[model samples]
Target: MATRWGLCGAGKISHDFSVAMKTLPPGDHQIVAVAARSLERAREFAKKHSIPKAYGSYEELASDPEIDMVYLGVLHTEHWRLGLLVLQAGKNMLCEKPFAMNSREVGDLIAASKKSNVFLMEAIWSRCFPLHREVRRLLAEDAIGDIKLVKASFGSPQLHIPRSVEKELGGGALLDIGVYTLQFVLMVFNGERPESIHATGVLLNSGVDESMVVVMKFARNRLAFCFFSIAVSLPNDATISGTKGTIRVLGPMHCPTTLEVNGKTTQYPLPEPSLPLNFTNSTGLRYEAEEVRQCLLKGLKESPRMPLSESALLTEVMDECRKQVGVVFNQDSQ
Candidate 1:
C-alpha cells in the first residue's frame, strides 16, 4: 500500500524530498498533492512532480482527505504553527528538522499529536542512515568503550541566503546546522541531555547567530564540543573519542555514507540515485521514509530510532545553548 503524501511548501527542501521520493519503488509512496502560498507555485510544483492536486493554501492541503501523511517542508519558525494545523487536520506528519524554534513549541506539538492520535516525527533523516545505525550497534557493543569526548563541526558559507541570517525566519547557526552537531553528540551519548551547556556565538548585524561553538558537560566525565557556522567554511567532520579508541566520521559527516573507527574505515554506499541533485543526501531520505512507512503500518506513533522525546530533548538543549549564547529569535519572546 502506498502512503499518500500531502506536501506542504514548494521550496528547495520540498523539491529535494520529491526528488528523493522518485527513487523509491513504485507503490511505496505517492505524493498526492502539493501546496504553496502562491497558486502558481503550487501548480508548478505539482506539474514538475506529476502530482494530481495543487493547492494555493495550506488550509486546502490540510483538508485533503486523500493524504495519509504530510511532509512539512516549511521554514524553521513555521514548524510549530503548521504542525499544529496538520495535527488538527488529523494528519500524520514528518516535519523538517530543528523540529521547532524551542522546547516549549516542541512540547505543544507533542501534545497536539497525542490529542489528535496521529503519528508525528521530526525529519532528522541522518539518524535513519545505515552508517548511523551501524555506529549505534557498535557503540552498544562497547566498540568505543566509555565515550569521553565527542566533537563535530558543520559550517558553510551560506550568508547570502536570507533565511540563513534573518531573525524572523529562525535563522542561526544553532537551529540551522548546529542541530546536526547537537544530534550527532546526543546519538553518541544515547540521547542523554548534557549537564551544562556553555556556548559563544558571533551574531550577525541582523541579530542572528552567524557562527557558534558549544561545549557541553555530561555525566561520567563525558563532554561534547560542537562548532557550526553560516558564514564560514569548516571541515564538517565528527569524532567520538573514548577510553579504548576513537571513531571519526569523514568530512560532510552530517549525511555521511562513510565513517572511520579505530583508524579503520567503512563505507555505506547509498542506492544508485535516480536523480543527480546535490541536496542534503536525498539518496538517504528513502531510509527515513521507509521507517515512517513501516511504523505507520504497525500503528506506531513515533519512531523508536528518532523518538519524539529525543526531538524535544534536542530542542531543550538548543534552547539552553541559545540562552547562554544570546541567539534570540523573535518567537523566543512570544
Candidate 2:
C-alpha cells in the first residue's frame, strides 16, 4: 500500500520533498495533495509535482481523508500551530528541522502526538544518511579508538535570504545551520548529554546571531567545539580526533558522503532513486523518508534514529545557546 503524503507548504523545501517522493518506486509512496496560503501557488505546485489535490488553506489539507501523513515544510516559526492542527485532524507528520522556537513548544508537540496517537518525527534527515550510519558503525567498532574531541564549522554568505536574517522567522546561524554541528557532535558521542555548554556569537542588527562559537564539555573528559557563521564562508568540514587516530569529513559535514577515517577514504553514495528537482539537497531526504515510512508501517510513533526525546533535548540545548548569546524571538514568548 502506498503511503499518501500531503505537503503542507509550497516552498522550496516542499518542492524538494515532492521530487524525492516522485523518485520513489510506485506503490511505495505518493504525494496526493499540497496546500499553501495562495491557491494559485498550491495549484502550481500540484501541477509541477503531479499531485492530485491542491488547497488554498492548510485546514483543507489537514482534513483530507486520503492523506495518511503530512510533511510540514513551513518555517520553524509556524511549526507549533500547524503541527497541532494536523495532529488534531488525525494525521501523522514529518516536520522540518529546528522543530520549534524553543523546547517548550517541542514538549507541547510531543504531548499532542501522544494524545492523538499519530506518528510524529522531525525531519533532521542527516541522522538517516548512509554516511552518518557508517560513521557510527566505525566508532562503535573502536576504529577511531577513544574519542577525545570533535570540531566542526558551517557557514555561508546567506544574509540576503529573508529567513536567514529575519527576527520573527527564527533566523540566525545557530538555529539555521549550527544545529547540524551540534547534532553531529552528539551523534559522534552516541547522544551523551554534555556536562556544560558555553557559546558566544555576533548578533545582526535584527537581534539574531550572525556567527557563533560553541563549546560543550561532556563526561569521560570529552569535548566538542563548533563554529557557525553567516557573514562569511568556512571550510564546512568536521574532524573527530581520538587517542589512536582521526576521522575527517572531507566535504560538507552536514550531508557529505565522503569520510577519511585514519587516512582511508570511503564514499557512500545516495540510494538508487535519482532526483530531477531544483534542490539537490532533496537527494538525501529520501533516507529519512524511508525511515518514516518504515516506522509508520510498523505503527511506531517515533523513529529510533531520530527520536522525539532527542529532538526535545536538542531544542533545549538551542534554547540555552540562544540565552548565552542573547538571541530572542517573538515566538519564544509563546
Candidate 3:
C-alpha cells in the first residue's frame, strides 16, 4: 500500500520536496494533495506536481481521510500551529527542520503525537542520506578513533529574502542554517548534550541573528565549533577529527553527497530529477520519504533515524544558543 502524502505548504522547500517525491517509486509513495493559504497557489502547485487534490486551507487538507501523512513545510513560525492541527486530526507528520519556534512548542507537539498515537518526525533529511549512514557505520567501527573535535559551517547570503530576516517569520541564520552544523556535531557525539555552550553573533536591526559563532564542550574533552551566517557566504563544509584519523564532509553539509575518509574521497551523486529543484541535492530527500514509508509499513510511531527525542534535544540546544546570542522570536515569550 502506498503512503499517501498531503503537502502543507507550497513554498520553495515544499516544491523541492514535491520534486524529490517524484523521484521515488510511484507504487510506494504518493502525494495526494497540496494546501496553501491561497487556493490558486495550492492549485498551481498541484498542477505542477500532478497531485490529485488542492486545498485552500490546511484544515481541509488535514481533514482528508485519504492522506496518510502530512508534510509540514510552511514557515518556521507556523510549524507549531499547523503541526498540532495535523496531529490532532489523527494524521502522521514530517515537519521541516527547526521543528518549532522553541523547545516548549516541540514538547507540546510531541505530547500531541503521543496522545494521537501517530508517526511524527522532524524532516532533517541529511540523517537518512547514504553518505551519512556510511559515516555513522564508520564512526561506530571507530574508523576515526574517539572523535575529539568537530567543525562545521553553513552560510549563504540570504539576507535579501524576506523570510530569512523577518523576526515575526522566525528568521535567522542560527535557526535556518546553524541547525545543520549543530546537528552534524550532535551526530558525531552520538547525541550527547554538550557540557557547556557559548555563542556570539551579529544581529540585524530586526533583532534576528545575521551571523553567529557557536562553541560547545562535551564529555571526554570533546569540542565542537560551528559558524553560520545569513549576511556572509561560508565554505559550508564539515570536518570530524579524532585521535586516529579525520573525516571530512564536503560543502553544503546539510544535503552533502561527498566524503573524505583519511584522504580518500568518494562522491554519492544525487538521483536525476525530471524537474529543476529550488535547493541543492534536494532529490536526496527521497531517502527520508522512503524511510517514512517503511516506518508506516511496519506500524511504527517514530523513526529511529530522526527520532522525536533527538528533535527535542536539538530544539533545547537551539534555545540556549538563541538566549546567549540575544535572538528572540515572538514565540519565545509565549
lDDT, candidates in the order shown: 0.89, 0.87, 0.93
Tens digit of per-residue lDDT, candidate 3, span 89-128: 9999999998999999999999999999999999999889
What is the RMSD, in Å, between candidate 2 and the native fold over all Cα? 1.6
Clashing pairs in 3: none
| Better TM-score candidate (1, 2) | 1
Which regions of candidate 1 deviate over 4 angstroms?
A: 276-278
Q: How many residue pairs clash in each candidate?
A: 0, 0, 0
Query: Which lDDT value does model 2 have at 104?
Result: 84
RMSD of each: 1.2, 1.6, 0.8
The candidate 2 region of ten consecutive residues with least summed lDDT is 271-280
What TM-score fits each model?
0.97, 0.96, 0.99
Best by lDDT: 3
Query: Candidate 3 — which residues are off by over 4 angstroms?
Result: none
* Worst-scoring 10-residue span by lDDT in model 3: 184-193
107 in model 1: Cα distance from truth in Å?
1.3
Question: Candidate 2, residue 26: CA error in Å?
Answer: 2.1
User: What lDDT is obtained when candidate 3 is compared to the true structure?
Assistant: 0.93
Model 2: how far residue 328 lies from native, Å: 0.7
228 in model 1: Cα distance from truth in Å? Answer: 0.8
